[model samples]
Target: MSKSEYNTEDFVLDPEFRKWVLTNDPEAKRYWEEFLSTNKSKIQEVEKARKILIHLSQERFALPDSEIDLQWNMINDKIDHMEGLKRQTKVVSLDSWSAIQHHKEQSRQKRKRNFIRTAVFAFSALGCFIFAVWFQSQKFDDTQEVELSYETMEVPAGVKSNYLLPDGTEVTLNSQSKITFEKNFSGDIREIELVGEGFFDVAEDSLRPFIVKTQQVSTQALGTAFNIKAYPEEPISVSLIRGSVLVTNSEVSDFKEKLVPGEEMFATLDNSTWIKGQFDLKQALAWMNKTLIFDKTPFITTVHSLEKWFGVTFTFENDIPKNLFVTGEFKDESLKNILDGMSYSSRFSYTIDGKKVNLKFKP
Candidate 1:
């Protein structure tokens, strides 16, 4: 039969359909998606078949093919034995058999009908037995403990990394950032633990919420783009680029705030108080696009930004200048150029040793 006419049984028994439901094959995914889109009327049947296939894939090892065949054979043997008894019951003495041959023939026909009915019942029983076994196997699987594994990705200082999650969410990790998540998110929720800084373009799935947890706060999104910066010993900042997200204290659930586009929420690690304010898109995403913008930033804060940007460490020999501010916009500029430009105004000298930089007050 053509695919358009295929019934639930046909789909369940199809090898290709089973493969698509069980494995990660791009072609199979496309084919099924397209098919379902065009044949919306068949969605119920398709879903039923898909669920059965997925269940079978999980419990396939519970019952071997050989064992299933042995059970069928045992059922059939019992049916055959009953049929033999029916045949023996139809026998009669020779004198009575001739005298009531017509009645005897009717009785024989009745016996045949009884045998057929018994065979059908036996087959139906067999089906019920198989279904029961599958149901019990599923129950056993549900109760069994599952050990979850995790995967981690880290971006060192002076570098950035981009990753695509299994659910098609896009993430860009900033310098000295790390994210850890389950290797296979086969659960109801999609969750990630993040440290440092990262930007996310989350895919929308109302059924499963995407969550990013930091040391101080947690950001939850349902199909939104946002940036989060939560470095140790610094205030946690969450910026929303598009869509909306809920920011909540990791320890205190009641301390929550909602963020909209072009808005930022900040929370300190020590205090759970949340502060929301307007944020500059250019300043927030400069690092992602390989640009640096220091808009009236303090001299010491600038030093920290440079270290993270260039993957270097900074040390001060003398106390940093009080009330010193620096402002600049650099697109793909070298660390030396940035420091040189800043020094022309800040009037401080700096020396570089491998990955370390030292600043001292000039006499």
Candidate 2:
């Protein structure tokens, strides 16, 4: 933080600063926004410098033949302009170097003019080099001023989104889910926090492991493909499709659970604990296929699942039968049809109110 030996170059190359840029940290963005807002006058030249530097950086950077021609033309043009200017102002002896003895034969006046011509380009070069360093600094300062904010986009029903993480992991976020990652995923540990459901196809980086944290549990993997379900009202669940995963709850004494392909572990709420069980991959992941598989699932839990999967709400009034086990599978069924099926079983009757459904016992 000392300014005594403050080298801007060191600041530009600082690993943490670069990492913040890469991650697009909101705090970093806010700091830059506040700093630039306050330091506008002191860094005004940075604006000009950034415009030119950004254009230069965008040019196809390579030792191309066209670039060589461009450089050559610039040098030739500078030499031509100086010689032409000298001709208009004052003529200089071209043979000054040939004969100092011949200088007297020419004139002292022309010798002085010739020296002035030679000094013109030398001063221009020095001036240009000086400006080049200043201009470069301006670009770096502009970068410091630029505010970058990283955000997570929510996925809605009937649509899926695919995105890349900094660590090259591929995430296919399901409807109503989101994933937030640190700007520098390659820090001590590559970690992401997931809300709702997502399918991860993580690229293998052995040196730094990948971790996904939810409300109830944390999943660690070296490289794998898996589905995570962690809706707030629903149980926290993970189903590994391929590779391996280790899940642990920070609160529990024995929290570690190893999951293999086609296996799942669900963490329940409050007094309810984690359930490690074998699951049929197709039945477990039927939602992804736009199918609902309710094999021996309770009517109450089934209603909750329907609410979340379709972004609907359910309510029950009056006394309702406890443990009204509703089981079966349905694909793309209408809400009325689903409710009617449950009512036929004399378990619960329901009526739809906008996106919400009210349930009660038959009178």
Candidate 3:
């Protein structure tokens, strides 16, 4: 039969469909996405099949091809038997019995009908028992745990993005950030590795704590909203907006600190000690609102932020002023406008050509 006519069972049995559901194959993903797009009605069937495959795959005891075929054959045989019984019973109508001999025959037929009903009920009960046994067996077998496939998402410099995780957590990724996460949150913990900065509105899962792992630290939260800035070579910062988070230094696994609302944790990659204190939420989350807020920030740091914010490469034509600091807020401002504002105060001339900007400090 054509793929469009496939039912849930058919989809589950399909090798290509199972591969797409189990492994992270770009070709399989592209094929299935295009298939579902055209065949919209089969979406629920495909999803149901995908879930069944995922469950079976996690248990590491998926039905073998031969076993699957055998079970399906048995099911089809049972269905055919039920149809035959229905046909036989349909021919014997109540109106057909009239004479004395016929009444005797009807009495015998009634006994046969009762026997058929009992047989059908027994078969159904047996099927239910078998299903229950299989389900329970799969549920409690914890000897083997399989590793799940992971996928990575990267946002290039000068562009910010947002993504929804499998567990319904909302993530607002800042410019030049990358996040690597599991394709599905089937593990004990909903974990993700982040590079650069991201704001997480974590989904509440009491059973599975949402964890954001940076190079030097790991932040664990359950139903909390927080932000983490962990760009390479820069100090890592975890700013909690609401709820609470437990921050642990990866280098010093014994070191852990709990953070409450409005608190921020700062840890340098080069240092083992971390500091926690109150933070400015607006300043921390300014990128989310397409704004940049500088609080007497060093010129080099400000340039780094601007480079990521506008997707530009900055080159110093002359020696950068060591005393230069910028303090301002620019919301949805052009790169030229921001540069102009900064140049007026910092006494620097800059030329923007394509993606590169050259800065010359006025003497």
Candidate 4:
């Protein structure tokens, strides 16, 4: 292993560092960059926090209430005090476990006493547990539901998956993208979130339109076929094939536009800028054809896509050069081969491990 495996302990016990990571504030970016260059002391803590941050940063697509409930139950079981103890033992100090256990004991005794007044007290406690579970199940049923959905889907490179939505929309997801949506998919407006890229053949539902929400803007359609390429690191773009669509950023009232077939819209997380232009649907949605496209994309931008699309990581010895850009494409390219092709142009240099591909200034 490399000498600098990145100690996790320093990030854990160091309040100055922990506070920097706990929030989504962009103000913390500088600190995170600095920490990356610093010593790696707290291995477990940093790893744990890193994972939590990854998960939280990830997009959550809409799931049916039933599916969501099932997922919540599984998560709830693991997140209750018991699972917390296990995670703390592995990632942080867990002396608080005793306090938790003590409280649990007290609660148990109180519940035990309360049951005594009733005949068949053991049966009463069992009934209460069952009732509590059923009530929770029913409680979720009362929640709202939407219609059509668009979600950012993520898959590792060399793998492909297909998704069928409630509205009869079919999405064939590519590696490392995600889709998020509301359950009913109908409301004051229809909405779905997307990251990476996906080929969407949306089913028509006139009552509630279909919408795709990306880091930058939203795409609304009645029943259309289109593809969206929206990476937070890069501006969002949409290419429609079959039907017309509207792209708008109600989030930034100033930014709004309508799109028709063969047209595309581009926007970003920065400054709510929105742009519209024509697109070659064939070239734009090529990922549906097992192809990866790049056009004057930045070195880091490509790296970020690879990480998500292929589940890889890239480190750098020094800061990436400013204003660097890459123009190329990959079709089922191996990680090493793709990096080599980029470097062939004298633009970037890189090293590869199992999942990490480190790029550095060409020395």
Candidate 5:
């Protein structure tokens, strides 16, 4: 049949039409769009076929060929029986019997043609549905083979790493930090699980929200830049830079808060309470710029940061100093330099042993 004479069944069976429905090919899309604009009368059939294709794409199961054939046979038998009943119910009067018989024969032929057309259309639709099911089943099987495929990046103590995600999001991983995500990010959401600290400059995608999940909290953003610090023993904090984000306690689904630029959200792993306030951008992003800032940082906290930054282990010879606070800024400085600068004011002595550092009070 000519393209213009094609009906719903013909459209459904057309390979080109199916391609337009199932793929993102620009040429196919353009052709179909133009065709539909010009063939307004066939719009209904095109839409129906499109919907069937979409339904097939989302289906995860397929009917077996044997089952499909069985169903088709049952439907065909039922249609045949209905046609036979129409044939048996006919009665003709003796008066004008010839005329009546001719009329009845013509009517029967018309009905037969109509029935065949209807049956063909119905069968074609069923066949498309089955094809969709089988296609989805194969796709599901393919996905199952790669569902465990993931990419992981980790930065050891005393070092950092920078990476770009497939979606164009930039990430700066801090010392002893790790991020795990799907290899292809083939999902409705772009999600990454984080351990330790990382700064993310996410690409904007309204349809796919970027989520950073930590042990304590989860932060979600769309086209925003933010930093998350979630050390194993410390409180998790999210610092927003240029865009907005939503932070929520992982343990408490109802506990969610939105953060604006310059705002930081803090939540401890042990507690459900969340705190938010303005954060110092320079201090939060100091590591990314190779700068370390200690504004009255505690001795223990300082030790933790130093260990990660320098890839070393710290051993305390005596009890940790009480009420001790240190403040300093080192930009691209050596580990020894930072320690020497802090020891002068903290009155501590440290000896380095390969990757280990021992600290004690100087008499």
Candidate 6:
């Protein structure tokens, strides 16, 4: 039969479709996804088949060939028996018409009840099958459902990583950052846990809000591009570049802040309080463009930034400067050049040996 003519049972029986749903075969996945996208009418059937396979697989059992054959045979026999009863009607002579009419009425009622019972049996079985399939597909009932498995992606220091999430959201992970999310985003919410920094271009999913949870705060967005800086020991800063987002503190129950484009929310580790204000887009998002900007940033803060950017370790050879600051912008520059520029303003000398750097201040 043509694919257009394929029904739910056909999809469930097809080996390729079963492989895609059960084993997540990549080739099968690609073919079925493309097919379903073009043949929208088959989408529901395919989903039903997928859910059935998942349910059956999780049960650690499959319908035996004999059992399946028996079920089909029983249904066919019941249908044939009903048809035979329909053809069993006969005419009676008028001489005994009263008695004959009464007998015929009783038989008619008996047939009706039997037919109703048979129909109910058939439909009830089908309904239960479909219900089991749908129940297995739902991941929203946390109280009864198994906990979803999550996968974590970590970007090593000195290099950034770009990825497309399961829901088509684009993520740019900065160095020394990690993101953990459900394998397929299978729940009512598409949520992720983030450590360090990353930029998110959220895919628009109105039914399921996208949430990014940090150590002390959580940012929820429906469809927006935002940047988050959540490194350890520093204030968690969420900057909304486009669209709006709701920011909430994890520690405080009544802390909720809404952010618009060009706005940023900051939550310090020290307290449950948070602050929101207008953000400088150019400075806030400079890292995404392979640039770093410092506006009179502290010398030690600059060192920490360099450590993550270049995957290096810095050591102070002498007493650290009590009051020193550096201001500069470096775009895709070498580590040596950045240090050289900062040394002029901060009166510091630095030596780079492999992945370690030594800094000395001139007295």
lDDT of 2 at 141: 38
Compose the digit string of candidate 3's lDDT tens values, residues 141-170. Answer: 334555568989899998999998766689
The whole-model C-alpha lDDT of candidate 2 against the native structure comes to 0.68
- For model 5, residues 46-70, the per-residue Cα lDDT tens digits are 6555544554445444567887687
Model 6 residue 123 distance off true place after TM-score fit, in angstroms: 19
The TM-score measured for candidate 5 stands at: 0.63
Q: What is the TM-score (0 to 1) of candidate 6?
A: 0.67
Please write out the lDDT profile of model 4 over residues 1-363, one tens digit for every residue.
332443333333344454454442345546554545464454334445443332222423234577546654654454455545754765433478977876786698556544543434345445554454334333322133323334434655646689876445898876766777754332334567777677889876443578887765778898899888775566677787888887777567776667778777766768556567888765686667766788888877777767766677778888877878888878877777877887877456777888877777765
> Ranking under lDDT, best-scoring first?
6, 3, 1, 5, 2, 4
Per-prediction TM-score to the true structure, in the order listed: 0.68, 0.57, 0.67, 0.52, 0.63, 0.67
Once fitted onto the true fold, the runs of candidate 6 whose alpha carbons sit more than 4 angstroms away are 1-143
Candidate 1 per-residue C-alpha lDDT over 1-363 given as tens digits, one digit per residue, 9 for 90 to 100 = 777787776776666786666663567767776887788888766765655555555545344667757766765677678767877886555686575995777698668756765686567666664675445434534345555677899999999999988667899999999999975454457899999999999976544589999986889999999999998888889999999999888577568788899999988888745689999999899989999998899988888889888999999888887899989999999988888898888888898899999988665
Cα lDDT, model 1, residue 92: 55
TM-score of 2: 0.57
Clashing pairs in 3: 158-311
Candidate 6 per-residue lDDT over residues 91-172, each given as its tens digit:
4456677678867976986787577667866785677666655455454233556445789999999999999886679999
Clashes of 4: 32
Candidate 1's C-alpha runs over 4 A off are 1-137, 140-145
lDDT of each: 0.80, 0.68, 0.81, 0.63, 0.79, 0.82
lDDT value, residue 67 of candidate 6: 66
